[model samples]
Target: MAGILPKLIVFMAIFITLLTVIVDGESHSFSKTLPLRSKKLKREKMSHLHFYFHDIVSGRNPTAIKVAEAESTKTSPTEFGKMVIIDDPLTEKPEATSKLVGRAQGIYAMASQSELGLLMTLNYCFMEGKYNGSTLSILGRNTVMSEVREMPVVGGSGLVRFSRGYAHAKTQWFNHTTKDGVVEYNVYVIHY
Candidate 1:
């Protein structure tokens, strides 16, 4: 009976150690191995998408602008134009478009154009309720444009800098030309 008890203890210890190793191995593998692949994929996708958006924005397309504007208006109608909402305690009217532009310019001076573009893309994703991990395939009709703006937080103490802007479709049937050669459109701007 004494010998049998000792053997049982040894077996149990070995079993527990093996179990722990297996569990920890899986956890380590997932965190260390999978993230590398995931991050690489994300970077690759973002690079491809950046080029695509840049092309579309630089391209002279009127239809794309109309579609983007329509989509932005449909998604965020209340926040569409500059307006004073004195009655609403939750919202504060922005100071001015020029002020927002000034803030953006300051931030833009510090960052590279690619970084700014990435920031704008991220803002659009947040406003659109799209996951950042998801791929953005820009077709002729589904193009995006971004504008940078600085706005004071509605209730917070400090000002929040953001790329608040909109995107438009470049190949829609109803297209309008802005004073500049660029297509005129509205993009869902991010507050943060």
Candidate 2:
């Protein structure tokens, strides 16, 4: 009877531990958790599109006049470099406007590193502002490395979040020619 009681107690302890693990695992949450693969398609369909630009060589300027003009005027461009037009709407308030402009500049800086064939680095800038009459919170910035291949594509998605919204920017650069080593770049952004 004593031996049977000890074995039963061990079994009960293992069962309780397993139950505790299952409950705790289901409750963990991060502020910026990524969507599961099954949910990605649905989320992408509802997301607004934004454009990202990269300059892949030093001293070379953007060939597109429209892109240059938009940068000089501090207006966001729908299409630039290898990017295409998309329907991401900006928040109409002055505070939100400024924040987006600042973010654009930061993107430019990060892209410049890709020009030198280096991986870009993005840091968390918890700047304060307002968006849609609500307090704006800068979650964090994610830096994705560019790759050189036959058809260049951004390796991973870079993400930035606000209090009520978030943005994903992806970028890549490929060496198109060995002679003079011309590099081609493409960037994509999606907002939700």
lDDT of 2 by residue, 53-116 (tens): 3322323443211222234333323212222111112321222122231122222222222232
Error (Å) of candidate 2 at residue 153 is 12
TM-scores for all predictions: 0.19, 0.28
Model 2 lDDT at residue 100: 34
- The whole-model lDDT of each prediction reads 0.25, 0.31
Where does candidate 1 stray beyond 4 Å? 25-192
- Runs in model 2 deviating more than 4 A are 19-24, 27-100, 104-115, 123-191
Backbone-clash count (model 2): 0
Clashing pairs in 2: none
Tens-digit lDDT string for candidate 1 (1-192): 989999999999999988997887756544654554543332211110110111121244411122122334344423232111111000011211111111110100111222221112112111112332222211121112333222221111011122223344231122235312222222333333
